[model samples]
Target: MTVPLAATDFHADLDLALRLADAADEQSLPRFDAADLEVSLKADHSHVTDADLATEQAIRDILHAERPDDGILGEEFGAEGVTSRQWIIDPIDGTANFLRGVPLWGTMIALAVDGVPQVGVVSMPALGRRWWASAGDGSWTATSDGARRLSVSTVDSLDEASVSFQSISQWAQAGKTPELLALAERVWRDRAYGDIFSYMLLAEGRIDMVAEFDVKEYDIAAAVPIVREAGGRMTAFDGTETLSALSALATNGILHDSFLSLFRDLPRA
Candidate 1:
C-alpha cells in the first residue's frame, strides 16, 4: 500500500514568499512607466524591462541570503541551484501592460515543494493590492481598506458562472477557438481579464473561472495555492495537477470537473 505524503507546515515559507514580494515591489514599482526605463526583446519576442531583471534579482538575492538551499526558477533569469524545494519568480507577470502604463501587472512568487506549489504570493504594488496563500493556511488578499480571507464563488453551473478567457488570439493560436467559444457560450458572461489578475479575481470570488493557454510554471505556480486555498480548484487544461503543462484552467471547486468536461473531447496538450 502507498502512504500519503505527510503534511508539512509552510507558515515560514509563506512569510518568506511575502517578504520576497516586498523586495520585488520595492525594486520594480518605481520603474513602472518611467521615461528612462530600458526595454529589450527576448529571443522569443517577449518584452523584458529593466524592472523585470531588477525585481527578479532582488528576490534571488533574498533567497540566497535566507534560503540558500532552495532552488529558483525565474522568468527573467533561468533556473538555479536545482533542488526539491524551489522558489518560482515572475518579476513582472504582464510586461506589456507594465510598459504600457497599465496597472494590471504584478510580481509573482511561489515555493514549490517536491513539485507541488505550497506557498504563493502575487503583489500588485502599483494598485496597492496583494494576495497570498500557503497549504492549509487559506488564501487572503489586501487592499487600502484592510485584509480579508478569500473565497471562490459558489456558482456550480456554467450557465450561471462568469469566466475570463485571457486572450482570444491565444485561443485561436492554440486551435481551441471552437472549444473556447463553446465554453463562453455556456457561461453567463465572458471577459478578458488577462494575466495574473484574472486568477486573483477568481480567488476573490468576483469571477468564477479563468482559462488560458501558453503559460509556464512561473506564470501560474503562485496562483495554484491561492486558488486552492480560496476553496477553488486549478489544473492544467488536460485535468492534470501540474504547473509545467503550459496551460491552466481555474474555477470554484464545485465547478472544476464540469469545466474540465468541456474540454474532454479535445486532444491533450
Candidate 2:
C-alpha cells in the first residue's frame, strides 16, 4: 500500500531526519553503558534516562533552527507548536534496553503532514544500521557495501509466518494474552523482538509480522513510511489506518488481512 504524500517533495525533510538521527546517536552512544548514566521514572513509572533527554534536545535544537515553523511532538519534551507539518520524535525508543547496555535500542524520527507520516528514519547506531524512507520513495537501509532497498517477505500464511509480538507483558496488560497466544500457536514461530527493530526486520523481509500494544504515535510514526514503502502494510490492530489507536499491527502486504482478523473483535483503545 502507498503512503500518503503531499504535493511537496519529501527529500529535504527526509535528509533532515537522517541528520537528526545522527545528532541523536552522537548524544546517546556515549552514555549507553556509562556507569554514571542517570535513570529516572516518569509519573507512569516508565524509565527515562539522561541520554533520552539530551538526545531529544539535540534533535530539537536542529529543528528549531532549520524548520522553525514546523511543530514538534517529542517523547521527552511534549508538544511544541501546532501546525499541519510536525516532527515526531522518540529519542531513545528502547530506553530500558539502552540503559541495560543491550544493543537493540535506537532513535526514531518522522515528519507527519496532517497527521500522516511522509518521511521516516530509524537509526540504530549501536548496531551500525539505519533505515529510512519518504512517501513515494522506496525504503532503504544503509549497509557497509552501500545501501540496499527493502522489501517485505512473501510469507502469505499465518502458519508459515514469523511473528514478533514485542512484549508478552504488554499483551497481558491489555487483556489480549489469549488472543496473542492463539496467534502465536498458529504462526510458525513467535518472538518478542521488542522495539522498532521488529518493524525494521519486517521491512527488510526478514520477518513477516509485528504486533504490539500500548504504543504512542512516536513509537510507530517513523516506521509507517518505511514499512509501507517497502511493500508492507501497517495499521492499528483493529484494521483502522491510524497511529492514535495505541496499538499496531504491521505485516507483509500479502498477510495483512490474515493478521488483522485475529484481533478484529477486540475493542480498540
Question: lDDT of candidate 1?
Answer: 0.91
For model 1, the stretches where C-alpha displacement exceeds 4 angstroms are 1-5, 265-269
Error of 1 at 7 (Å): 1.7
Ten residues in sequence with the least summed lDDT for candidate 2: 1-10
* Per-residue lDDT of model 2, residues 7-119, tens digit only: 66899899899999999999999999999999999999999999999999999999999999999999999998974899999999999999999999999999999888989
Q: What are the lDDT scores of the predictions, listed in order?
A: 0.91, 0.92
Residue pairs that clash (backbone atoms under 3 angstroms), model 2:
none
Model 1, residue 116: what's the lDDT? 88
**What alpha-carbon RMSD in Å does predicted model 1 have with respect to the real structure?**
2.6
lDDT of 1 by residue, 174-206 (tens): 888888988877899999999999999999999
**Which candidate wins on lDDT?**
2
Highest TM-score, which number?
2
Candidate 2 colliding pairs, count: 0
